[model samples]
Target chain A: MDTTQRTEQQRSADRRRRELLEAADRVVLRDGPQASMNAIAAEAGITKPILYRHFGDKGGLYAALAKRHTDALLASLRAALDAPAERRERVEATLDTYLAAIEARPQVYRFLMHPSDGAPGEQGFDVGKHSAPVLRRMGEELAQVIEERLDLGPGTQQLARVWGHGLVGMMHAAGDWWLGERPCSRAELVRSLADLLWGRLAAAGDKVGGPGF
Target chain B: MDTTQRTEQQRSADRRRRELLEAADRVVLRDGPQASMNAIAAEAGITKPILYRHFGDKGGLYAALAKRHTDALLASLRAALDAPAERRERVEATLDTYLAAIEARPQVYRFLMHPSDGAPGEQGFDVGKHSAPVLRRMGEELAQVIEERLDLGPGTQQLARVWGHGLVGMMHAAGDWWLGERPCSRAELVRSLADLLWGRLAAAGDKVGGPGF
Candidate 1:
């Protein structure tokens, strides 16, 4: 009952949580979005009750997994941004990371986008709920860059937020669509998206008579 | 049977089809995306077999509703486009119709996006599968408009298809996001979205150098 014992117990619990999450990811990837709780528990080599004890339920588990995946994606994007490049190149790099993440783990992405066990009466699939942290980070990053560099106006932050959502949403839909129909190569799709986004952004920047894109 | 009797039976069957689809819509709205065959049949004052008879299975039923809803939306957009005005005005009106339809029946949209009983191990949602007719129409309309009016190159058709998908996907995600987070009024949201769409669109058109907004 001493502090060291308590700390040891907490560490063990955290390790168990990580193990369960890793099992859940494998099950989800293998079974697609409709992977069952029993399957997840089985994959973890644990009972369903133990799985539920660690994570409240399927939704909680999905949310935790979503947070994990979103953070990883954001980290990739950050790394992409870190590479010294032009503004447009940086945006492309970020998008490339986003799309690649979705491509790499589409089942997890779809499960996050629309969990099969979503509450019965909700009208709309709350994409933001599943990935609010990433959305917030994307908005902050874009808004910060626009304000610090572009100087679009007092409304730059709001505009950047709107644009950020638009871009994120675009990628979300485009990624899903591309997963279904490979009308173009991944590189081509990425380039087309980058062109559309960077073209508009640069044009808007020019209209404001601000920094060169 | 006599011709008149056959015609009467056909009319009655059509009526039943419409009734069942309406019931399905109501069930989906009330129960969100987890709407079951039993609930749909109960809503229609029929049995599950009868419900399945009309649409085969849940996926078939979803596909039927998707076609119905997508058709209705395309009709509204066509009407919006028919309004005599500038090109920009027409585009805004069309987008307004699209967003309004989604807002009006977000449950149908969500159900279409992700049926609770999606087939096991399905990789992609295949949104265009459910709405291919609309996508085709939108692409043809935009490409023709660009071709006839703008005199863009032969590649304009492909560009229009890509842009059509991009625009549709953007609205899809943005509409879902707005459903969850009403950061702005519908009018303001529509206007802002139109500005982004039309702004990028007009900029693209100008580079082609054919038409003036």
Candidate 2:
């Protein structure tokens, strides 16, 4: 094809892919991590074989959908992290940003981070394998930011990376439990987590007539 | 059967089950998370059917294996947490205990926590589903300890629960990454993580000629 025709075809193909991804997302929203290929294809008004042709398989489709959401969530987190504020305010904002996202679209968050939290069986892709990379990616991205911005002396890079993964993990585990139990309000969770980052756990006194944690 | 005979039979059955589990452990150590029923049976000097008879299925076997490792790991962690030391010392010791366990037996840790880290398709059970509950249990256990020991005042229980999960998560994620990369000595990892919990991140200064983290 001529260069202009090829360019036109590429644009159309990209648009079609985006449309397919949106359909897949809707299915995930409804069915959760157990979203099936048949359901997605039907949602998009396409046949199963055609859907496979576009995305390769369930794993491929999942990767694409995860990327779309992870990218968006990361962008919001970046904004929160980069905002001009004191360190504590920025930390709370970032925590709130993550909690708010997960709180709003828990299904998507579950799909991306805890696919196996859904009822199992009939899933063809390796759910655990896929979900972890998203966390690892977020951890790595946060590590880069920490390394670039913070003045951790001596082995700054290594310390930043460790803190990056450590912070992400703390957020994820806490958020996952919070989502399940709703034990406290989102503000409380954010405040509690920021307090943790700020070292209140160390500062707290031992309960009277008891051994300390 | 007589009561004494029945009791003897139960004790023998328990012994047999433990033997089978030990065999399974050996196979898992050799083969990582993909330790198959056939391999386990062979290791136990038995057939596949016999292995199934004991554990019900791959999922049952996996649960048993996970519980064994988790119980042992938790015991060590409890010791570290309960040791009569300063809070910082206890925290470092706890972090070190976990890291040491994972470093010494990465394969077992991977099998329990990241079964999908191994090659896929051969796994019959829901690896992700099983692995997460271990972390959840650890988090809850830690939360209880924090709530009981720390005097945070007012919403102390809820805050303790949040920190419980968050701290466990931080340890897990950092340890997981460190195990894979060996970026620093275990001591350094422990200190950095302890520093993180002690509010070093919030106390850190901005890098010269750059925005702060």
Candidate 3:
């Protein structure tokens, strides 16, 4: 085929892949990880054969979907870290960005958070592997700020781990609950969580000698 | 329908139900909630007919298993609450009991904490509803302690919710991460959690005057 035809074919395939991923997200969110490939293909407005041609199978489709979201999420986190801001401001902005991403694509969040229940050899994607470096970088940056602001001892890494996990788990639970048929606004939910987390951090700092000064 | 025969039949049925529930737990844990009735029956050393005779169907069996575990867990919580101890000590004891229960039955703990991805109307096996009242009672009791010890006004209920969810989430996450895996003993896990919580409460009280004192 000529270069023009080849490029056109590649673009068509890329669009199809993106469409399949979008449909997979819908299926997983609406029906969960147990959603069947036939259902996903139907949702994508494609034939099952075509879906198989693009993704190989349900497992490949799910993995590609996970990887796409994980990449997007990490990129957002990196952007949050790179933006110039005060320490507290950066933390808050990063959290807000994280929360917004989860809210917008709750299925992606659920896929990452829950254990994979798919067939053997179809282990659900692992965000921990993808997100660990981002977390480490965030921790390193936050630790430096913490050291400059507080008399953090050698235990800062442990503290950061605990704090990071606590915040993540807190947001996850709150987001899950909110996703249920609840009556709270996102702003209210975010504020309640931010207050609980920031309040605890502020208290920790006060107890540990008022942030280095 | 003689009394002796009737009693024997009842005993046999009870044994079958127990076996089925235990098998269901194993199936759900090893395989996700989608484990088939045929698989569960095989695991229980019974034919499909006997499994059906015992529980009617898979949903009924799953619900029965969930209800049974939920009752046992709540009973443990009640026992902890009834133990004669100071208020703070009682809370600590309750935390320990909760941790132990989760540690002992990690699979059941996971099922109860997170909703299953089963058919619609199958996710109501909520241990949280059963435990929420117990938590509310503890919160009220703790409110009295806070009233006597701290001067925080009108924030007791909200604070209790925050503290309650935090402690529960912390312990649940710890159980998920540490059960059969972590180097820390249950006692150490409980102590660290209790200390972190109570330390925060004490410091918060110091910041705002002692409530109702």
Best by the lDDT measure? 2
DockQ of each: 0.13, 0.59, 0.08
Residues B1-213, candidate 1: write the lDDT tens digits. 599999998999989999999988887777765666777899999889987777866657777777877667767776776676665676677767877877887766666654442322222223323433344455445445433433224454444445556666666556656766677677766666665654432232211221221
Can you list the residue pairs that collide in candidate 1? none
> Stretches of candidate 2 above 4 Å error?
A42-49, A122-124, A211-213, B36-53, B120-124, B211-213
Pairs of residues at least 3 apart in sequence or in different chains that clash in candidate 3: B150-B210, B150-B211, B151-B210, B151-B211
- lDDT score at residue A176, model 3, on the 0-100 scale: 47
Native-referenced DockQ of model 3: 0.08
* Model 3 stretches with alpha carbons more than 4 Å out: A1-16, A26-34, A43-57, A70-151, A181-213, B1-16, B23-35, B43-45, B49-56, B77-96, B107-152, B155-159, B180-213
**Per-residue lDDT over A34-98 for candidate 2, one digit per residue giving the tens place of the 0 to 100 score:** 76788888999997997878887667887888889999999999999899898799889998999
Candidate 3 chain A worst ten-residue window by lDDT: A204-213
Per-residue error for A124 in candidate 3, Å, reads 12
Q: Model 1 chain A — which ten-residue stretch has the worst lDDT?
A: A204-213
lDDT per residue as tens, model 2, B189-211 = 99999999899998999878895
Assess candidate 3 and give its TM-score to the true structure.
0.61
Q: Rank the candidates by DockQ, best first.
A: 2, 1, 3
Give the fraction of true interface contacts kept by model 2: 0.77
Docking class of 3: incorrect
**Candidate 3's residue-wise lDDT over B28-129, tens digit each?**
787655466777888888778888787765545756766777667767776775566654576568768887887776666656544343332222232223
